[model samples]
Target: MSKDPEDRLTVGEVSRRTGVAISALHYYESLGLIASERTTGNQRRYPRYMLRRISLILVAKRLGISLTEVQHVFDTLPLDKLPTAHDWRRLSRLWHTQLEAKKREIEQLERELMGCIGCGCLSMKSCRLLNVDDELAELGPGPRRLDAAQAA
Candidate 1:
Protein backbone atom coordinates (compact mmCIF):
# COMPACT_ATOMS: atom_id res chain seq x y z
CA MET A 1 0.00 0.00 0.00
CA SER A 2 1.19 3.48 -0.84
CA LYS A 3 1.28 6.09 1.93
CA ASP A 4 0.45 9.67 0.94
CA PRO A 5 3.82 11.37 0.63
CA GLU A 6 2.54 14.50 2.32
CA ASP A 7 1.40 12.55 5.37
CA ARG A 8 4.80 10.87 5.78
CA LEU A 9 8.24 12.31 6.35
CA THR A 10 11.59 10.72 5.56
CA VAL A 11 14.20 10.39 8.31
CA GLY A 12 16.21 13.19 6.77
CA GLU A 13 13.14 15.34 6.47
CA VAL A 14 12.30 14.80 10.14
CA SER A 15 15.90 15.61 11.12
CA ARG A 16 15.84 18.81 9.07
CA ARG A 17 12.48 19.96 10.40
CA THR A 18 12.96 19.00 14.05
CA GLY A 19 16.71 19.70 14.36
CA VAL A 20 17.13 16.30 16.01
CA ALA A 21 19.88 14.12 14.60
CA ILE A 22 18.89 11.09 12.51
CA SER A 23 20.62 8.78 14.99
CA ALA A 24 18.78 10.36 17.91
CA LEU A 25 15.45 9.86 16.13
CA HIS A 26 16.33 6.21 15.65
CA TYR A 27 17.33 6.02 19.29
CA TYR A 28 14.02 7.58 20.30
CA GLU A 29 12.23 4.95 18.21
CA SER A 30 14.26 2.19 19.82
CA LEU A 31 13.21 3.47 23.24
CA GLY A 32 9.54 3.55 22.10
CA LEU A 33 9.49 7.31 22.65
CA ILE A 34 8.71 7.60 18.92
CA ALA A 35 7.89 5.27 16.08
CA SER A 36 8.10 5.10 12.31
CA GLU A 37 7.18 2.82 9.47
CA ARG A 38 9.45 1.11 6.97
CA THR A 39 8.80 1.78 3.30
CA THR A 40 8.76 -1.21 0.96
CA GLY A 41 12.45 -0.43 0.29
CA ASN A 42 13.09 -0.45 4.04
CA GLN A 43 13.63 3.30 4.42
CA ARG A 44 12.22 4.92 7.54
CA ARG A 45 9.06 6.96 7.11
CA TYR A 46 7.60 8.90 10.03
CA PRO A 47 4.10 10.29 10.25
CA ARG A 48 4.00 14.05 9.74
CA TYR A 49 2.46 14.47 13.16
CA MET A 50 5.65 13.05 14.65
CA LEU A 51 7.19 16.50 14.19
CA ARG A 52 5.10 17.75 17.08
CA ARG A 53 6.02 14.69 19.15
CA ILE A 54 9.69 15.36 18.51
CA SER A 55 9.23 18.95 19.63
CA LEU A 56 7.64 17.79 22.86
CA ILE A 57 10.51 15.37 23.44
CA LEU A 58 13.04 18.14 22.90
CA VAL A 59 11.21 20.43 25.31
CA ALA A 60 11.12 17.72 27.97
CA LYS A 61 14.82 16.98 27.50
CA ARG A 62 15.70 20.67 27.83
CA LEU A 63 13.91 20.62 31.17
CA GLY A 64 16.25 17.78 32.24
CA ILE A 65 13.50 15.18 32.14
CA SER A 66 14.90 11.71 31.51
CA LEU A 67 13.87 9.77 28.39
CA THR A 68 12.40 7.11 30.65
CA GLU A 69 10.11 9.71 32.19
CA VAL A 70 9.15 11.05 28.78
CA GLN A 71 8.43 7.54 27.61
CA HIS A 72 6.21 6.95 30.61
CA VAL A 73 4.16 10.02 29.74
CA PHE A 74 4.09 9.20 26.06
CA ASP A 75 2.88 5.69 26.81
CA THR A 76 -0.25 7.20 28.31
CA LEU A 77 -1.19 9.02 25.12
CA PRO A 78 -2.73 7.74 21.91
CA LEU A 79 -0.15 7.06 19.27
CA ASP A 80 -2.26 8.16 16.30
CA LYS A 81 -2.57 11.89 16.98
CA LEU A 82 -0.56 14.90 18.08
CA PRO A 83 -0.62 15.84 21.75
CA THR A 84 -3.08 18.67 22.42
CA ALA A 85 -2.34 21.93 24.25
CA HIS A 86 -4.21 20.56 27.25
CA ASP A 87 -1.72 17.73 27.39
CA TRP A 88 1.18 20.17 27.38
CA ARG A 89 -0.39 22.23 30.15
CA ARG A 90 -1.00 19.14 32.29
CA LEU A 91 2.60 18.01 31.88
CA SER A 92 3.89 21.49 32.61
CA ARG A 93 1.93 21.59 35.85
CA LEU A 94 3.28 18.20 36.92
CA TRP A 95 6.87 19.08 36.05
CA HIS A 96 6.63 22.44 37.81
CA THR A 97 5.69 20.74 41.07
CA GLN A 98 8.51 18.23 40.73
CA LEU A 99 11.09 20.88 39.82
CA GLU A 100 10.04 23.05 42.75
CA ALA A 101 10.55 20.14 45.14
CA LYS A 102 13.97 19.49 43.66
CA LYS A 103 14.86 23.19 44.03
CA ARG A 104 14.01 23.12 47.72
CA GLU A 105 16.14 20.02 48.24
CA ILE A 106 19.08 21.65 46.48
CA GLU A 107 18.70 24.78 48.60
CA GLN A 108 18.67 22.67 51.75
CA LEU A 109 21.81 20.89 50.60
CA GLU A 110 23.48 24.23 49.94
CA ARG A 111 22.78 25.32 53.49
CA GLU A 112 24.23 22.09 54.87
CA LEU A 113 27.26 22.38 52.59
CA MET A 114 27.97 25.91 53.83
CA GLY A 115 28.05 24.63 57.39
CA CYS A 116 30.49 21.90 56.40
CA ILE A 117 32.78 24.45 54.74
CA GLY A 118 32.78 26.86 57.74
CA CYS A 119 35.35 24.74 59.62
CA GLY A 120 37.82 25.00 56.72
CA CYS A 121 38.17 21.21 56.72
CA LEU A 122 38.43 19.25 53.48
CA SER A 123 37.18 15.98 54.94
CA MET A 124 33.99 15.65 56.92
CA LYS A 125 34.90 12.14 58.06
CA SER A 126 38.39 13.12 59.20
CA CYS A 127 37.39 16.46 60.75
CA ARG A 128 38.28 16.49 64.45
CA LEU A 129 35.12 18.24 65.55
CA LEU A 130 32.63 16.48 63.25
CA ASN A 131 33.73 12.86 63.19
CA VAL A 132 35.56 12.65 66.50
CA ASP A 133 37.60 9.40 66.44
CA ASP A 134 35.80 8.21 63.31
CA GLU A 135 32.56 7.76 65.21
CA LEU A 136 30.53 8.17 62.02
CA ALA A 137 32.31 5.12 60.59
CA GLU A 138 29.93 2.94 62.60
CA LEU A 139 26.93 4.58 60.93
CA GLY A 140 27.96 3.27 57.51
CA PRO A 141 29.07 5.14 54.37
CA GLY A 142 28.09 8.55 52.82
CA PRO A 143 27.36 11.88 54.54
CA ARG A 144 25.96 10.26 57.64
CA ARG A 145 25.32 13.47 59.57
CA LEU A 146 23.50 15.07 56.65
CA ASP A 147 21.59 11.90 55.95
CA ALA A 148 20.61 11.59 59.60
CA ALA A 149 19.61 15.21 59.80
CA GLN A 150 17.50 14.95 56.67
CA ALA A 151 15.88 11.79 57.94
CA ALA A 152 14.92 13.53 61.16
Candidate 2:
Protein backbone atom coordinates (compact mmCIF):
# COMPACT_ATOMS: atom_id res chain seq x y z
CA MET A 1 0.00 0.00 0.00
CA SER A 2 1.06 3.55 -0.59
CA LYS A 3 2.13 5.57 2.46
CA ASP A 4 -1.00 7.66 2.19
CA PRO A 5 -3.94 5.30 2.33
CA GLU A 6 -6.24 7.59 0.35
CA ASP A 7 -3.79 8.07 -2.50
CA ARG A 8 -4.93 6.26 -5.62
CA LEU A 9 -2.49 4.66 -8.05
CA THR A 10 -2.06 5.94 -11.57
CA VAL A 11 -2.10 3.52 -14.49
CA GLY A 12 1.68 3.56 -14.48
CA GLU A 13 1.84 2.63 -10.81
CA VAL A 14 -0.67 -0.17 -11.26
CA SER A 15 1.17 -1.41 -14.36
CA ARG A 16 4.46 -1.35 -12.52
CA ARG A 17 3.06 -3.07 -9.46
CA THR A 18 1.23 -5.77 -11.39
CA GLY A 19 3.84 -6.34 -14.11
CA VAL A 20 1.07 -6.01 -16.65
CA ALA A 21 1.73 -3.87 -19.68
CA ILE A 22 -0.05 -0.54 -19.68
CA SER A 23 -1.64 -1.23 -23.04
CA ALA A 24 -2.80 -4.64 -21.83
CA LEU A 25 -4.44 -2.97 -18.81
CA HIS A 26 -6.25 -0.66 -21.18
CA TYR A 27 -7.28 -3.66 -23.27
CA TYR A 28 -8.62 -5.37 -20.15
CA GLU A 29 -10.67 -2.28 -19.40
CA SER A 30 -11.93 -2.27 -22.99
CA LEU A 31 -12.88 -5.93 -22.54
CA GLY A 32 -14.71 -5.10 -19.25
CA LEU A 33 -12.43 -7.37 -17.23
CA ILE A 34 -11.34 -4.38 -15.12
CA ALA A 35 -12.44 -0.80 -14.54
CA SER A 36 -10.87 2.52 -13.64
CA GLU A 37 -11.90 6.12 -13.03
CA ARG A 38 -10.98 8.87 -15.44
CA THR A 39 -9.55 12.01 -13.91
CA THR A 40 -10.76 15.42 -15.00
CA GLY A 41 -7.66 15.66 -17.21
CA ASN A 42 -8.54 12.22 -18.70
CA GLN A 43 -5.93 10.29 -16.82
CA ARG A 44 -6.85 6.89 -15.47
CA ARG A 45 -6.72 6.38 -11.71
CA TYR A 46 -7.03 2.86 -10.42
CA PRO A 47 -7.79 1.80 -6.90
CA ARG A 48 -5.25 -0.50 -5.28
CA TYR A 49 -7.83 -3.28 -5.34
CA MET A 50 -7.69 -3.29 -9.12
CA LEU A 51 -4.36 -5.04 -8.79
CA ARG A 52 -6.24 -8.12 -7.62
CA ARG A 53 -8.59 -7.96 -10.57
CA ILE A 54 -5.71 -7.62 -12.99
CA SER A 55 -3.98 -10.55 -11.34
CA LEU A 56 -7.12 -12.65 -11.67
CA ILE A 57 -7.47 -11.65 -15.31
CA LEU A 58 -3.87 -12.59 -16.01
CA VAL A 59 -4.34 -15.98 -14.36
CA ALA A 60 -7.53 -16.62 -16.30
CA LYS A 61 -5.87 -15.67 -19.59
CA ARG A 62 -3.03 -18.06 -18.82
CA LEU A 63 -5.60 -20.82 -18.34
CA GLY A 64 -6.96 -20.24 -21.87
CA ILE A 65 -10.02 -18.32 -20.70
CA SER A 66 -11.08 -15.93 -23.46
CA LEU A 67 -11.69 -12.22 -22.94
CA THR A 68 -15.38 -12.96 -23.29
CA GLU A 69 -15.17 -15.46 -20.45
CA VAL A 70 -13.24 -12.98 -18.31
CA GLN A 71 -15.90 -10.39 -18.96
CA HIS A 72 -18.57 -12.86 -17.94
CA VAL A 73 -16.84 -13.33 -14.59
CA PHE A 74 -16.47 -9.59 -14.13
CA ASP A 75 -20.13 -9.16 -14.93
CA THR A 76 -20.91 -10.97 -11.70
CA LEU A 77 -19.63 -7.95 -9.82
CA PRO A 78 -20.88 -4.39 -9.79
CA LEU A 79 -18.88 -1.96 -11.88
CA ASP A 80 -15.82 -0.57 -10.04
CA LYS A 81 -16.34 -3.03 -7.16
CA LEU A 82 -13.49 -5.44 -6.50
CA PRO A 83 -14.13 -9.10 -5.99
CA THR A 84 -14.86 -10.27 -2.48
CA ALA A 85 -13.59 -13.51 -0.98
CA HIS A 86 -16.87 -15.25 -1.75
CA ASP A 87 -16.64 -14.11 -5.35
CA TRP A 88 -13.11 -15.44 -5.65
CA ARG A 89 -14.22 -18.79 -4.27
CA ARG A 90 -17.00 -19.00 -6.85
CA LEU A 91 -14.71 -17.98 -9.66
CA SER A 92 -12.06 -20.47 -8.61
CA ARG A 93 -14.55 -23.30 -8.70
CA LEU A 94 -15.71 -22.30 -12.14
CA TRP A 95 -12.18 -22.00 -13.47
CA HIS A 96 -11.22 -25.37 -12.01
CA THR A 97 -14.08 -27.07 -13.84
CA GLN A 98 -13.21 -25.32 -17.09
CA LEU A 99 -9.53 -26.15 -16.67
CA GLU A 100 -10.35 -29.80 -16.12
CA ALA A 101 -12.43 -29.91 -19.28
CA LYS A 102 -9.63 -28.27 -21.27
CA LYS A 103 -7.13 -30.75 -19.78
CA ARG A 104 -9.25 -33.68 -20.93
CA GLU A 105 -9.56 -32.18 -24.37
CA ILE A 106 -5.77 -31.74 -24.57
CA GLU A 107 -5.23 -35.31 -23.46
CA GLN A 108 -7.63 -36.55 -26.14
CA LEU A 109 -5.82 -34.48 -28.77
CA GLU A 110 -2.47 -35.84 -27.62
CA ARG A 111 -3.73 -39.38 -27.98
CA GLU A 112 -5.00 -38.57 -31.45
CA LEU A 113 -1.70 -36.91 -32.34
CA MET A 114 0.17 -40.04 -31.21
CA GLY A 115 -2.07 -42.11 -33.41
CA CYS A 116 -1.35 -39.79 -36.34
CA ILE A 117 2.39 -40.02 -35.71
CA GLY A 118 2.10 -43.82 -35.67
CA CYS A 119 0.72 -43.56 -39.20
CA GLY A 120 2.58 -40.94 -41.24
CA CYS A 121 -0.50 -40.40 -43.40
CA LEU A 122 -2.28 -37.17 -42.31
CA SER A 123 -4.84 -37.39 -45.07
CA MET A 124 -8.53 -37.23 -44.13
CA LYS A 125 -9.34 -40.37 -46.11
CA SER A 126 -6.84 -42.54 -44.24
CA CYS A 127 -5.74 -40.78 -41.01
CA ARG A 128 -6.85 -42.95 -38.08
CA LEU A 129 -6.32 -39.99 -35.77
CA LEU A 130 -9.17 -38.08 -37.40
CA ASN A 131 -11.36 -41.17 -37.68
CA VAL A 132 -12.08 -40.00 -41.21
CA ASP A 133 -12.76 -42.96 -43.50
CA ASP A 134 -13.47 -43.32 -47.22
CA GLU A 135 -17.20 -42.84 -46.60
CA LEU A 136 -16.57 -39.39 -45.04
CA ALA A 137 -14.65 -38.25 -48.13
CA GLU A 138 -17.99 -37.80 -49.88
CA LEU A 139 -19.04 -35.41 -47.09
CA GLY A 140 -16.25 -32.92 -47.79
CA PRO A 141 -12.54 -32.33 -48.49
CA GLY A 142 -9.62 -31.86 -46.07
CA PRO A 143 -9.87 -32.27 -42.28
CA ARG A 144 -13.18 -30.47 -42.67
CA ARG A 145 -14.37 -30.80 -39.10
CA LEU A 146 -11.32 -31.98 -37.11
CA ASP A 147 -9.84 -28.44 -36.81
CA ALA A 148 -13.09 -26.50 -36.60
CA ALA A 149 -14.66 -28.51 -33.78
CA GLN A 150 -11.73 -27.82 -31.41
CA ALA A 151 -12.11 -24.04 -31.78
CA ALA A 152 -15.88 -23.97 -31.45
Clashes of each: 0, 0
Quantify all predictions' global Cα lDDT against the true fold.
0.83, 0.79
Off by over 4 Å in 2: 1-7, 128-152
**Residue-level lDDT tens digits of model 2 in 66-144:** 8798888788876666678898899889999989998998898887787777577767666656553466667677665
Against the correct fold, how does model 2 do in TM-score? 0.77
- Which ten contiguous residues of candidate 2 have the minimum total lDDT? 1-10
Q: Clashing pairs in model 2?
A: none
Q: How does each model score on TM-score?
A: 0.77, 0.77
lDDT of 2: 0.79
By lDDT, the best candidate is 1
Q: Write the per-residue lDDT of candidate 1 for residues 1-152, one digit (tens) a residue.
A: 12677799899999999999999999999988778888889998999888888998998889888888888888987677777999888888877887898899789767666777757775767654566568888889899878989999
